[model samples]
Target chain A: MPKIKYIEENGKEHVVEVPVGWSVMEGAVKNLIPGIDADCGGACACATCHVYVDPAWNAKMPPMGDMEETMLDFAQDREATSRLSCQLKVTEAMDGLVVRMPKSQH
Target chain B: MSEQIVIIGAGQAAVQAVTTLKAEGFAGSIIMVGDEAYPPYQRPPLSKAYLLGKLERERLFLKADSFYPEAHCQMLLGVSARAIDRKAMTVLLSDGSRKPYDKLLIATGTRVRQIQVPGAELPGVHYLRSIADVDRLSPEIVAGKKLAVVGGGYIGLEVAAVAQKRGLEVTVFEALDRLMARAVSPQLSAFYEQAHRAEGVQFCFKTGVEAFEGHGKVERLRAGGKLYPADLVLVGIGAIPNVELAKEAGLTCQDGIVVDRFCTSVSDPAIFAAGDCTRHHGHNGEEIRLECVQNAIDQAKHAALAMLGKPTPYREVPWFWSDQYDLKLQIAGLSRPGDQLVVRGDPATRKFAVFHLREGKVACVEAVNAAPEYIVGRKLIADGTPIAAARLADTAIPMKNIV
Candidate 1:
């Protein structure tokens, strides 16, 4: 199991044990987190699963692909740390990694 | 260094455009003016899950409450953009305020087209478009009351599915020969019609609503020389683009606001249009307007890139999906009326994909309860890969191997 921590917009942190193959967005959704509405499922079409990655964990995550980047352009309140959680696959190196949900998932 | 980007309507397109602007490194002041009070939300679920009490109001929201401040986007709700002063680059609001903009995006979307029949304005006669519409109709759906849906299109069929699931007697009236005739193939429509009918949904195909017979509320619908008794009636004939504001502002307007391939207004460079309101020039030299969430998001991206001067031509394939009674019908690409359809798999087994071919090229695909085929079909349509009809119809050939 891969443990992941999500820091919501309200600054509350939740630690959940997720399967390695599932995306971070799937983990949040399956856990019934407050934010992260994956409207189009795991498809890169909708940007409702946007999250701001902790700068410390940026090196551990893969670079944002063109499709993910293009999808992120549709997310509200984007930042340099912004990444679509659906595109972020959970791995062992992602333990203790923190991600903040966007204020809006529109 | 204050550049202003004003979005005319605060629906999905406006919300996505603002988000895209921020992602693309636009530090300008973004303002979204919407006539509705609520923030951007998903409308597709209104007819299905939301109406059936399967989804809460919060679940239908596109963003949380903290979205506006976090995105640095100002949302002026319950305010309509009345007019546009092209020469001064300003938008006149209904509240007697004028906002200047360096660039403007018209995402007014569309309004439900109502049937012009007698008793059309009856109290119980409704059209589903906004959240309020769904909220008003939810109780009726849950009560398992009789519902007469006056169109066999996607909206009507979806509502019928939800109503039937909620134990209501649903009767869909379609003027066309079959359900979803304009958007789907005959075989696909027949499958849906059969599925819906199996779920106790009655249909009146090739029949038009002559009138609604009721005094204070809807009591019955007169169609096909017969009166179908009903407690409630919902008219889902179609939708017309909200192009009055654009037309009054001297913009090129035909069926919708005319825009180039880049989603820029053909008559003005600073003005761009997207979503259901703008008819952009398609690859086939036809001006087409799509009313899907995919189009809204993709067109918003195109418009945002164009506004930033990093223009990308809008060439993404349009796809749409509808959920009805355990069936997830996903469509990849657009198909015209006369397009050829080839079926893969068994319709009788309730699992199949119908491929629409144009000039022997794969033009579009409609899949029923087939997610993998829909995904591959989306990629194939986007790639414009020429697939042989025989190979497409062959079940042994995997869709992944078609590429």
Candidate 2:
């Protein structure tokens, strides 16, 4: 399992050990963290799982797919560091990864 | 004593409501009653990836078993809500329990609209709305087995796609002239039909299912005076909201449990409704009853907020998606019959989007394997952004610059 840091929009922080094969969205959701909605359940069909990846850990993340990019545009307050958490699957390299929630999800 | 909140349904809406209540620091006891045996599970994947056996069964559950107790929510599974006693503010359950509630949330969702004809209750005849439904239906998707999918709607098309991929001989029998006639435009219907056909799925449009003619188990389907060989039959007609409890409790019922902007029942302030069971006002004063994950989750959030004494209006643009073969059709907002259709990309490329505009404003967009369009289209629909049709249709111009 890989440890991930999730930061809520209200400045609350939660650190959980996500299964390696699980998605970043699932990591937060399964831990009962109240940020990522993942309304589509990692299908990338909805943009409610938008999160701003930590600037330092951007290079370690999975490249955004066209579908993820498209859905990201639908997310509120999207930024350069923004990414759909569902697209980022947990791996050994993603340990200690930090992501911040948007003001609100779709 | 703290407030007693009872939620009559254990699906997406119930789980979301419980989550929101705990998150918002609501100090109360939450009780969830569901007819299903398992905890609150998602229905979207039941007809798609789960049906294909690609996704794990545990993934279907929205939350873990320990979550409810930690949130002070008691989930009463495998029990039916027999009645809602408004006078006593209590609910009678199938388990011979009467639980009193200060506030009640009706998230009973919907039941599969069964195909009414002879042999409908046959063992092999099935409807896909629950985890058990798919569990029983999954083993029937054997190679070389003939499958008759009724309705040609989202569930039907998704299942047909999965069955075809698993080597099942799939045939879709639609009562309408075109596939998904009620949901999508004619162009989209043609595109999806062509896609399914290319993948070896047969289509019988304008064919009404007269009956399921079989003995002990489903063997064949008779549609439009013709009998088709069907080793297993899937009825994907539609769903009917479970509103009898609300109606019996003296709540307004018009196609769905009628609720206000805050998801509170029109006649009872203490009773709120969400998900597919409730009809809420959507865009343009149009009352809509949506059966999708987006509506379930968003409306549940609204209902939970209102339960916490914060009534916020839910005005989310209704969005839905269906996966068939390689095409992922994503739709945002509602489109009318006379809305202008604009093509954003060439259909020949197998990746394109159709825009439905009302008075030159972006009303709805149906994107097939075109996420950029669907994503940006939702924003346009929500903002009511007036469009430049020429720029929108130009492949060179990005979606962000169109408005």
Fnat of the models, one by one?
Answer: 0.00, 0.64
**Candidate 1 residue spans exceeding 4 A from truth:** A1-106, B283-285
* TM-score top scorer: 2
Model 2 pairs whose backbones collide = none
True contacts kept of 2: 0.64
> Comparing to the true complex, what docking class would candidate 2 get?
medium
Summing lDDT over every window of 10 consecutive residues in candidate 1 chain A, give the lowest-scoring window. Answer: A66-75
State the local distance difference test value for candidate 2: 0.90
The prediction achieving the highest DockQ against the true structure is 2
Best-performing candidate as measured by lDDT: 2
For model 2, the interface Cα RMSD in angstroms equals: 1.5
| DockQ for each model | 0.08, 0.63
lDDT of 2 at B179: 89
lDDT of each: 0.84, 0.90
lDDT of 2 by residue, B1-403 (tens): 9999999999999999999999898898999998999999878889888999877888778886778999999989999999999989999999899999999999999999988888788889888998999989998899999999998999899999999999999999999999888899999999988989999999999899988877788889888898898999899999999999999888999999999999999999999999999999986569999888888989999999999999999999989998887778899999899999999899888899999989988899999989889878888889888887777899998877766
For model 1 chain B, give the 10-residue run with minimal summed lDDT.
B58-67
